[model samples]
Target: MTALYPLFADLDGRPVLIVGGGAVAERKTRALLHCGAAVRVGAPRLTRTLRAWAAEGRLAHLAEPYHEGWLESAWLVIAATDDRALNARVKAAADARRILANVVDDPALSSFQVPAIVDRAPLTIAISSGGAAPVLARRLRERLEALFDPALGALARLAGDHRAAIRTACPDHGARRRFYDWLHDGPVLAQLRAGEPAAAERTLRARLDGAGEESPPAHRLDWIDPCPADPGQLTLHQLRLLNEADVLVHDAGVGEAVLSLARRDADRHLLDAGERKDPGTLRDKILARCAGRGNTVALISQPA
Candidate 1:
């Protein structure tokens, strides 16, 4: 069940205890420190950096091996000692206390497995294979590191800063999604990658400004009307219409393969109808911008 849960950051000052002084313990300690956890390490000795942290009083260290009492007050625990018996003892203690525990290279004793993490600042990607594959995970991370530009972290931060305004402007979930689609498209990302921060900010702000307009055309109300299209010729018309749309509002569909031919970065929406179908007035304004610039707007139905 924990497998599906996201790896949340330790930004809330969670207490983590690492029981070891070796290289594995050192690696885990560094990661926890980077996440801003208040870390306490229990080991008979320490590495150079661990000793420095203790000297600086940045983290607490116990000059001893695993003790049953160390389990108290720890939110998460890591057993990285070479001693198998001690690692097993620590795992049992953690299980009794319901604390998340990770034993280095020991799957059965672990309640949670740490992934090969990629940190691009503000953007963190964790890859885990349920302990079935660690080397594969590292290789995958390496591949992803090449694909995911470091600039994405900065863009993510910018998006975070403007989130409130974005929510207000693009009130509907669908519209808001479309805006993000536009955001990740070549132009905006290119500007950011080129170090044109002002241009990027201006582009995003302009999008927000456009989306917040009071009202728009009735045809713009919903990306796809509730009515389903007839098969055959309608599909062709849908395809052609998709090509003309500056913004394409599409839900999960069997026709996605067809739709992909339209525009590489065209805004696509996946609508789960429980939420607002149309994000809001602001989104319509962005679509209007596309239309004004002679961009086509297409709405494709979800695949059956």
Candidate 2:
């Protein structure tokens, strides 16, 4: 199957319809409500939680089965009914209106797949297996959920709050990158983790105010061992450097799969395979790159 387009919708105040009264429908309704969507459930009967939510005005409950009218004003619809025939009818109605619809557990009828989410608030990560391997997707999400610390969101928000000030202080794009690198690597996040937000803010302010250490040398070469066929095999440290690198100097044997991990705007210099025999060639290339802006990272891999 082709890759699905990934999207995050702002459903605040937007109307959406769910055509089931079961546990699955309840799950979908709660998620939509959390996103501020105006949820309307069109089922003859609802589960206990759904009934309670309807009573509390959390969502509008239609005491009737699925119909074409429900799709008239909906931004999207979830057909979670146990009846496949009924679900198919809902899918057809939604299709006639050009509305996006997802029939639960039926990817063939779904216009969009709801990915397994790793919610870090401002830093949400989503994983999908193209509806081919849902268990695998959930497993990946679990790993990410554990890998990312809860305080990471606080760190992101703090950085967001200082965005304008950071931009103004570090006018040079390269300088701004270094400042952010320092911000992430420095004591600010540690202070936040220690439950000292005030201290964290002070540290951030001090750095922006030039009371912090000077920006590290931005023009240097850091080489990685030969890249494996899969870029995912690289360590986190290596991935971080690749993500932040402004320049990539590599032998042609290094695949695009690995090169794609670096900043899309980074400069790429492909060294001659034969040049590896003589260390002077690479040294000269690094020297030339050092004369310019930003830092360089080379992948000293096997010759093509």
TM-score of each: 0.69, 0.87
Per-residue lDDT tens digits for candidate 1, residues 128-226, read: 887888899999999999999978987988889899999999886546756787887747778889999889899899888999663433344233332
- Give the runs in model 2 whose Cα sits over 4 Å from its true position: 211-218, 224-241, 271-282, 300-304
Tell me how many residue pairs clash in candidate 2. 0
Please give the lDDT score for candidate 1.
0.74
lDDT of 1 at 191: 88
Model 2 Cα shift for residue 271 (angstroms): 4.3
The positional error of residue 166 in candidate 1, measured at the CA in angstroms, is: 1.8
Worst 10 residues of 1 by lDDT: 218-227
TM-score of 1: 0.69
lDDT (Cα, tens digit) per residue for candidate 2, span 1-304:
6769999999999999999989999988988998999999989989999999999999999998677877878999999999998998889888899889999969877998788988877888989888888889989999998898787788898999999999888877788887898888789989988988899999998889992345545476777866665798988989988987888888877899899989998888888766667776767766685566577787877633
Candidate 2 accuracy as TM-score: 0.87
